[model samples]
Target chain A: MRTKTLITSMGLFAMLCVVIFGLGVKGLALDETFRRFVLAALWVCTWFAAVVGLNRAAASDRNKSFFSALMLLPFDPALVYLVRLVSTLVWLVITQALLVLLAVPMLKFDFFSQPLMLAVALMADVGILALGVLLASATGRLRGGEALLTIALLPVTVPVFLAATGATEALHTGSGAAEAWPYVLLLGVCDAMFLALGLLLFGKLNEG
Target chain B: MKAKTSNAPLITLALAALGLIGAEVTLYLSYFYTPVQISAGTLYVVTPSSGSTINLYESYRIFFIHLPAAYATALCCTLAAVGGIAWLLTRKDAWQALIVSASEVGLATGAIVLLTGTFWADYAWGSGRIGSGWNWEPRLTTMLILWLAFAALLVLRRAMDTDKQRAMMTAVYGILLGPLYPLVSKAIEIGQTSHPKSFSDLLSAPEIATTKQVATIGILLALVSMVALRYCWNRLGQRMAQERAA
Candidate 1:
């Protein structure tokens, strides 16, 4: 089941990449710089999809064995949450790097021109995924969970979305990280704050 | 019982009407009675000069409506958040009703503010200068999302069959997501984008003394009227639901 979930998520990401690149090349006729922005957005979406997929799979497989496995794990639940958060961030960064490579040939400038953009994007993703996982946990236990999940999560993540869009724009304009770092920092602060809060609240909220 | 039950609705209607009258009077004074003034040391240029002349016109009228609606929405959001927290802590259905009422009113006022803001932005910023149409600036984007969130909460409430469960879940969302408004506003301000500052800072001396005061009064009255109406509607709905259950 886990393997199927992973494969389906990867397949969705691959299809998304193909469509985005095709549109960038054929439809929008976007320059390399703009293509990079689109690619970054796609990468973020891909990571988000994978995390969501994994969350849904875990939620559905709420059997005794699974709970036993979780109980037997050496790490604490908080530690597990941290590890998952870090792994998701790593996956997002890797996808972003891959996007940067694909975007390099079609662009007007090199990757080094917008180092801060990469950082901002990664931080924004971390914040989003952190909040997503938290809300997913809450909604996973509720009836009509998926719809409730979207409603609860989307508004909370608006700041991250705005920051990422702004940072991406700054990168394309070659405004440097100085202009965009504050937004990146804001996302980082929000991620850290919310992660801590979620960890503290998770036990109470998760109890049936 | 019917006579006694009807009194609450009557009182609510009377309060709403009085509040509406107050709002209208305030609007009249703001537009017709208030004197317009130029900025300090900034003279109006009749001829070509280095500085451009600023005019107070129809666009400024949006302020008469926008400020009050924005404040009202903020007030409603606060009330909703408080009510949600109260419901969570006390486990009271009355608090849940209050949360629902406030959420609905907040969503309505938010929509009004966004509409007025777009009109103001069109005239003030010049259409298409920022973006094609309704540029997704921070304030606008945040307000839009907040409005949608509240609307979704209301919808979720209606969809649920059991009142207790519905209220519980909705209250949780209302409390958790309520803070996003301030966060979004601060994030936008920090980002330094095309979102407009509230008119409190931009008014000239005469405009501030006359038009600003009137607008502020008008908005307060309107907000009171809307909230009263919504509160009454919520109470009525609760009563009806009780009757049905009985």
Candidate 2:
């Protein structure tokens, strides 16, 4: 069932991407920058939907066979979180790269020259996902888990969003990587701190 | 249910009230009576500056609210930690009460700090200069997260039917991770945006001698009054719970 769900979701995501790309090409053919923004927005929404879908799949009792497979598999939960983090990071980076690609034609400057922006975006996403997964795990145990998790996670993720957006904008404006490195490092440090703290406290939460 | 023959409550109340009053007087003197000075194209009129002085209205004036809130939040968190530790050691109801009260007050003060800080940021950084709306300043960010954590602690307590379980969990989290607040704040400070330094620089020489002194006293009094009222409410709550159990 989990495999089915994952496949269905992936298929849906692919379709959504194709539709967005088609729309971008048809309507905004000459406006590459605008196309990039639209594509990035679609990517962000798709990633969020995928996470919610996967979480729902995990919680459903109808997936007993899949649960057994998951249990038998050698993959650790932490590794699962890490992989999810990586996937989300890749999605965001792709969106960013697309934005830069389109911006090059419009802005008359090299948008992708600073590779560190991609690294920074990835770090920020890691911090965000770590915090998100921890809250989701906690809230998922409760009755109104998803709603509670949303409320609990949104405000906490504000800083990460701010850092990510600021650094991204700075990079686009042709700022040196060294200039924006501090914010990226800050995001990385926050990610590690929260991950460690969550792991330490999660055991207690699970018992209850 | 008779009162214990201890002056501890009275003393605490008095000290807290005194602190509040002192802060208030300092605020008055700093703004109303202090001389205004001009510096570098900006008019430096202290809080409650004289009516005639062209007050640049350096948004730092909001520090009157921000500083007290910061101090109160820090105090409450510390109290929560200490109370949690005491409860763990002694398994006493009084310690649990202390933890609950501290957490409540901490949450309230944290909210106030965030609000006032936003106002200050709006004035200093110009509205929407940092990020779109909210800037990822370390102090603001961590204070916010700490507030959420306390909120979670309170909700968890409410959700649990048994007092023993509630107290145990609250104590465990409070004592174990209380230090993380400062640690996280410090790391953010080192890694990210530049905000005011939290330590000694918070109270400058003129600030201490002037309107800040009055504001400090007023805040202390306000906090004392608030805590006293909360304590009374808590006592009533306990009595009702006991009556219901009986």
The candidate that wins on TM-score is 1
Q: Could you tell me the lDDT of residue B22 within candidate 1?
A: 70
Which digits, one per residue and each the tens of the lDDT, describe model 2 over residues A9-116?
555555455455556555553454653454345335434543464356435622354434443466665655555445544544444444445445543334346678
**CA deviation > 4 Å runs, candidate 2:** A10-58, A61-126, A157-163, B1-16, B36-55, B58-61, B77-99, B121-210, B217-221, B224-246
Q: Write the per-residue lDDT of candidate 1 for residues B1-246, one digit (tens) a residue.
A: 788667877876776777677778767866676555344234311111213333434456667778788778877777887887787678776687778878888888888988987766655553566564576656776888888878877866665545555666667667755666686457446554455443333454465456567666666666766776777777778788888999
Once model 2 is optimally superposed onto the true structure by TM-score, how far is the C-alpha of residue B166 displaced, in angstroms? 5.3
Write the residue-wise lDDT of candidate 2 on B1-246 in tens digits: 446413545666676677666766656665666544445233343321111322334455567767777777877777777887787678777777777787788889889988887666555542545463467666677777778767866775665445655666667556533654564456334434435543233244464445665665578567755655565556557767878999
TM-score of chain B of each: 0.82, 0.76
lDDT of 1 by residue, A27-116 (tens): 554576556656465545644554554355446545333533553566566665666567655655555555455555544225556667
Q: Which 10 residues in a row give candidate 1 chain B its minimum summed lDDT?
A: B43-52
Please list the C-alpha lDDT of all candidates, in the order they appear: 0.63, 0.58
Error of 2 at A99 (Å): 13
